[model samples]
Target chain A: GESVGLHLPTLSVQEGDNSIINCAYSNSASDYFIWYKQESGKGPQFIIDIRSNMDKRQGQRVTVLLNKTVKHLSLQIAATQPGDSAVYFCAENRNFNKFYFGSGTKLNVKP
Target chain B: GAGVSQTPSNKVTEKGKYVELRCDPISGHTALYWYRQSLGQGPEFLIYFQGTGAADDSGLPNDRFFAVRPEGSVSTLKIQRTERGDSAVYLCASSPLAGTDTQYFGPGTRLTVL
Candidate 1:
């Protein structure tokens, strides 16, 4: 079945450094993508989103890049902080209603 | 001004038992969704309710899984003949009417089948 997946299971970065998480999706029909952050004992929280029509979208210290040709998406976070340590996942909207999520990448920000 | 909320933060059941999970979506949100998350993995879509009706139920694993939203506010997910494989965190989310809107997720109900 068509699904989304992350390139790495874990990533470690310094507090002041920038972090980049990668995701690859197999569904070409997907038109929307989103990044979510899940902390310990909490549900997934919305981070940022991008549509197929656009290549990149930016939010507060976060950026989502979409590459439809390669079926890849990435989330970039600048100036990583302790509070940013969590599991990050990429989700794609293929059927226009339901979202399929990736396994997830654990982001660990070192002090 | 509250976010999505789910009842019985944690549930423990034995095989062959039945269980019901509840979800309360954000106020005024017209779209509700249910998902299942296993250990070390992301959420998998199960069903979606647009208002009081189910718009999509393609993600439901089998007939043992069922859900309903009568008043378009509180939704319940019922599981029958539970198996050990059913142990997972069931998540609920809500969004605006638009399909592409950002979804706000609840804390989730952790179900453990013993």
Candidate 2:
């Protein structure tokens, strides 16, 4: 089945440094994409989102970039903080309400 | 100002028994969704509700799994004849609308089937 996938299972970054998490999706029909962060024992928290019509979207200290030509998406966190340590997931919205999520990338911010 | 809320933070049940998980979405949100997250994996879509109607339910795994939203505000996910494989975290989320709105999630209900 077509699904979303991550390029890396884990990412470690030093505090105050930048972090980038990558994801790939196989479905071309997907038009909306979102990045979510989940800490231990918690549900995913919405970080940022981008539409297929746009290439980049930024919010707070996070930025989401979409490359429809390559079916790729990336989340960049500026000045990563220890609190940012968590698993990050990329999801593609399809069929209006249905969402396809990647396995997730664990981001470890070293303090 | 409150976010999504789920009941029974943790549920332990024996195989072949029945279990029900509840979700209270954010106030005034018209779209609700359910997902299941297994160990070392991401949340998998289960079902979706819009204004008391199941707008999409193709994500439901099998006949034993069912969900209902009677008044478009709250929902319950029912699992009949639960199996060990059904053990996972059930997450509920709600958005202002269905398609492009941001979905806010609940703390989730962790179910363990023994």
Model 2, position A34, has a per-residue lDDT of 93
Residue A22, model 1: Cα distance from true site in angstroms:
0.4
Lowest-sum lDDT 10-residue window in model 2 chain A: A91-100
Predictions: Cα RMSD each: 0.9, 0.8
Residue-by-residue lDDT tens digits, candidate 1, A1-111:
777999999999999899999999998899999999999899999999999999999999999999999999999999999999999999999888888899999999999
Lowest lDDT sum, 10 consecutive residues, model 1 chain B, at B95-104
TM-score of chain B of each: 0.98, 0.99
For residues B5-113, could you state the per-residue lDDT of candidate 2 as single tens digits?
A: 9998999999999999999999999999999999999999999999899998988999999999999999999999999999999999999998878899999999999
Model 2 alpha-carbon drift over 4 Å, by segment: none
